[model samples]
Target: MDLQSIKDPSFLKKMNNEELEALSADVRKFLVEKLSITGGHIGPNLGVVELTIALHKEFNSPKDKILWDVGHQSYVHKILTGRAGEFDTLKKFKGLCGFPKMAESEHDVWETGHSSTSLSGAMGMAAARDLKKENNYVLPVIGDGALTGGMALEALNHIGSAKTDMIVILNDNEMSIAPNVGALHTVLGRLRTAGKYNWVKDELEYLLKRIPAVGGKVAATAERIKDSLKYLLVSGIFFEELGFTYLGPVDGHNYEELFENFRYAKKTKGPVLLHVITKKGKGYTPAETDKIGTWHGTGPYKVETGAFVKTPASAPAWSSLVSETVRRLAREDERIVAITPAMPVGSKLEGFASEFPERMYDVGIAEQHAATFAAGMATQNMKPFLAIYSTFLQRAYDQVVHDICRQNLNVFIGIDRAGLVGADGETHQGVFDIAFMRHIPNMVLMMPKDENEGQHMVNTALKYDDGPIAMRFPRGNGWGVPMDEDLKQIPIGTWDVLKEGTDAVILTFGTTIPMALEAAEILQKQGYSIKVVNARFIKPLDEKMLHELFSAKLPVLTIEEAVLQGGFGSYVLEFAHDHGYQNIIDRMGIPDHFIEHGSVERLLEEIGMTTEDTVAKLKSITPKKQKRA
Candidate 1:
């Protein structure tokens, strides 16, 4: 029988074991073909086909809320939940979202893109269910890597203590975007491989229960023995001791096993931990062989060969520039050491990892620990470079404020992906780093116009060991600008005047610098002389420059690729408000609403971040000043 013939939702309930196996294979095949064109999380989706199938079969969604951690693995869930038709437009503009979308379907109860959040979301839903007298299962499928996050652990602690009626399907793929790290990962690893010893131990305990009145005493003793042996056999008694009902190391790929475990979990109550073991790339050879988690997300690729169709740009990515620059500096300076919270490959620290393996720290998904650890390193006079994504660094805000900034440690934070990250959407946007980082005391916040400036900023941070320093750079390639030969360190609280004009000024930084320059050129063409200033230091505003511009009676238009609320615009406004400047001031950037997935160019244009928009808006604002003829 054709697998596609089984169309009804009820058909999944009646599917025999063999038919289920065939269906899983068909789903994998369909995913490979569909994702080749659309280009999504192919490897993760392939890994979770059986788990997703089993989940839908066991629990009714929309009524029974299911939260997918990170949501990258939800392609299988989406395909099964009546979203298969829209899969062709995955991650495309106004099309199917790569992650779970609450707007997309009723089945997707909670929208998620970041990791380690589903558990907390699940807890909240479960609490609401109790309060509302709703009878439904809330299953949160969190990966092992997500479990390492402090929030996930905190959620786990709450669930364990609250004794909420829920099931947490621990999707152990031994990875989370990158390979898993930390003590928790080691514990899960031990549990995944503890099948043999656990089985033998269980059989012995079962036999011991056959004894008489002494059987009760023997069983109690056996329970203790089993608990001790569990700790001895595996590294993870951590979950069990925390008050979760540990279930399995069951094969997630096997439909029968996954279905059986899920069925059992559905019946069980009070936070059942169903540990399902899955491979990151289950069927695809290339993904299976990939160890660095490159296949976690990708653009279009050849299905048969698993080769990426388009080549990466000849220009080095911002990540590569930071990594290469830092690696070079670290090699020369013994104080420089690199640190990341499980983002070695994404941050392009592979070269640093190879050259300075001892100096590099992959602290898993524990961003808090990574920050504090860096702070501790700083205490020892070692220049710890905590290289993290701008969004991800938000996870360590408390640590930054409390641990490092509070103590005034000399920790260098290389905040990568620091602007409007395109396809990943709002949750991944690095926009608020400046706003957040600038607010902190004893923190030097800087953004570079190009790769050359990025390199110099690294040197600047290295040389300036007075306090904590943060330098942010946007995602994707630089404008192919060559580096300075002397590597002269730019002074703190300084702005570079790219285009010297008298009428108006376009104050900007990083990726927006090029656009600002373009806007200035457009204005210059139309008889509007506009000055373009690269506002390098975001925190300590260039007061001298601002005073000079205000004295000259030039209108200032503050532009950025970040959000308008609490952004560079707000900073400029606050500065002007304090200084009492009478000249006209305007702010331009992404609006307060969450931006959707699209190309950076497309999204920028749509958000009125282009040179044309700036020029038009500036012309409309100035209006030739209405000079009397």
Candidate 2:
């Protein structure tokens, strides 16, 4: 079948199971081909092909709302909802989003990029439906890994207690980005293996019922035995006890089984938990064999061989540099330990974990718990290095402020992907960390000019004992600068002057430093003397240096790859106002809007953070007298 001919999933209802199976194959083939060019959540979408097909066949979307938790697995849903045509530009700017986007189609009822939010969304929709006196199904497909999240558990508790009419499709793929951890995973594991127990219980009950003349005390004993067996056999009784009608560990790939369970769930009263098991990368050989989540999401890959199109890095990845440095420090400092919120691989902490297994902790999608756990470790005088993504760190804001910052615990927060992370788009962008982290007291926020400075910053953060310190680095490779022979500690709240001039000063840090330098160089050729300084520390503002710049009466341009509000530039403006300095200052950064997925260069250019923009801003702020001279 021509997949593009699918305008909506209404046609799916008319097709037989055999046709649906063929459609699933075609969909998988299309995804494998298209995603190989555009790159996306290939493994996840492949896993959900049949499940999504079964869903479309079972329920009407838009009318019957279906929410995808984390939404990366919504690719198949997108395809079924007549979006196969947009695969060529998947994850590109203004193209097909990797996750569910409501604007893209009416069928996409809810947008999600963050994990563990679907249950709450589904409950809201269900409540709305009930209030409006409408009859429609509300199903939230959530994974076992997402179930580990505190919010998902909270939503589950509330939904079960409220007795809201909704079907919770527990898509158990046994992995979320990485292998799931925590006790919840263990529960799901037991449930995954409970198929045999279910069969045994069914056989036992059948035999018990067949026995003739069974009555009174013997019947009561048999009933008690059956109940005991049920309690022993069914692993989902925990969900049942929570007031949900728990259904099978159904085969997610089997259309008939999925359709049957889904139909049963829709008819059931109150809330129903339809536990369905799926393989993460069901069809593709390389993705199917993915043990470490490399196939969870990916860049473009060769279709025939499954080899990723390689662009050899000119420098080391920032994550590796920070994690390796931390590992090195852990060897010398026994007090040092590592922690991540289910991102050990992303944060490049696998090396650290392998070397110091006892000291490494992947807290499994619980950012709040991870933050507090680090704080607890810090209270015992242990140096806890909490490596987390900049976006995810938002989830632990209260913990960072109330626990770590308030107590002035020595927690080294390695804020990986601290700027505009491309491809994954707005929800995954790290642009808000500066605005969020800078406001907290005892929080020292800093970025580095390059990999060399990044390592030093990591060293400085681990060495600092006064309060919680954060060293943020952007995604991808560094500038390939040579490393120092010996690790040295950089002074806190100090800025580095990369280029010296008198007419104007360009203050920037991290990924934007090169742009600032290039802009300054451009201004120099145009007869404008511009100074470039790496304002590495976002907070603390290098008061001494600010005083010098103000005293010199030089115009300043602050550039950051972060949000403009309450960001580094705002701090600079605040500093000038506090000191009663009349220095002219201009800020260049991401505007007060969400940036979409694209290449980093394209994103930078889109937001006008390029060298040309920087140069223009600096030229505008150049001292009038100096310009006239």
Candidate 3:
């Protein structure tokens, strides 16, 4: 069977269970081989092969909507819908998206990259379908881990209560990014191992009826006894209570089980929750054995050896630097506590968790809860370090504004991956945090120029006891700079002058600092004296320095690896305007549009944010002749 020749899932209608199983095997092989070169969510995709096949075989896609919750597991869906040939360029620039894209095919009804959004999206689509008097099934395949999300639970409440005709596929794999936690995980754990619920219930009812009701008497006592025992054994009781027709503990790998449950779900009226048990990384040995979620996604690997492609690190990752520094600081400060929303692995907080198990918290994909939970700790005079990715923190903006900032609580937010986060595309980009965080009152926002400065800033943020503060750090390794032997606190709201010049000033920080330095050196070689300033504090503009630049009437250029509007550049411009300094200024950054998936360097080049562009912008802004007296 040529996998690449697959045009659509329509071909699945004629195929029997044996053929579908074969197809699943073929799909797994294709994914394992293809993704070895171009890395992706191989573990998740491999888990869903049979389930996806059975879905297409049973239901009509494009017409019958199948919404993948996070979309990382939609690779099998993509291949069945004629995207197998595109695997070579998957997640590359101008290539197949890593997540479901509505633009890619009509089959992709609901586009999603974030978790727990599918049910809500499904409800909207269901409502629209009813309004238009159209009949079709809306199945939202959500993970057991996603059910912990506040939004998903809300949607479940609404959809169940409303008696909407839809199928909520509960794909229970015991993992999501990392191993799931909380009460929901416990419930699902019971559900996974709980044997023959109906048979046990029948046996219990039979025995209870036969046994005398010991003084209480009759069928009412017997019924009560049956009810009590049923809940303890029945996993579907949770879904049934929520008004969904509880269907399975179906084996996701078996086409027969998947097809049988999916059929039952389709015929059933109202909301049907088909609890399908899946094994994450079912086909491959290495991924199957992955315990720490290292194989959730990857950057290329060896197919034969299952080893990751080589990239000898020159420096510790930015996440490691920030998290390790916090762990070091925590040893001395008993008030310090660490929290992440299901990103202990991603944030490199494993060491912290290992050392301070009681002090560390893995909140499990609840950003809003994590934010307020950290705030609650802050109220107790406890230093809560809320480590969250910049993109995920957006979901908790209200908590950040209302609970954290309004109360003037001292919470240190480690804004991880705080720039254009490449391959994960626009959904995962950490570009908007500065724009959103700076405008909030009593918020101190900053980014460090290098690994040394990053660790110091981490120290600075933790020590600061006034209101809320955040330190944004980029993805991947640092510049291999020597770390200071002792942790030191940088002065709040101060900027560092990297190079001093009288003609023109280049204001930049974090990832763009090197670009600014390179651009300035190039300009100096071309007989122009240029000044480079590390504008570390984003919210508090270097006003005194700005005043000096204004008095000198030096042409200024601001560079940032974020959106130009409402960004660091805008902050500088705002300061200039407030003081009424009519200075010639130019801002270089990502424009008002969303940047797509690509290598960071390529994305920077595409947005004209490279050293060459910086030099060009500098040349255009500065006066031709430098008369240095």
The deviation in Å at residue 200 for candidate 3 is 11
Residue 109 error, candidate 1, Å: 1.3
Those runs of model 1 whose alpha carbons end farther than 4 Å from true positions after fitting are: 1-9, 196-235, 623-629
Candidate 3, after superposition: displacement of residue 144 in Å?
Answer: 1.2
Candidates 1 and 3 compared by TM-score, better number = 3
State the lDDT at 335 in candidate 1: 89
Instruction: Give each model's whole-structure lDDT.
Output: 0.85, 0.89, 0.90
Pitting candidate 1 against candidate 3, the one with the higher lDDT is: 3
lDDT, candidate 3, residue 205? 61
**Candidate with the greatest TM-score versus the true structure:** 2
> How far is each candidate from the true structure, as Cα RMSD in Å?
2.7, 2.6, 3.6
Off by over 4 Å in 2: 196-229, 624-629
The predicted structure with the larger TM-score, 2 or 3, is 2
What's the distance in Å from true for residue 251, model 3? 0.6
* TM-score (all chains, Cα) for each model: 0.94, 0.95, 0.95
In model 1, which range of ten residues has the least summed lDDT? 1-10
**lDDT of predicted model 3:** 0.90
Model 2's TM-score against the true structure: 0.95
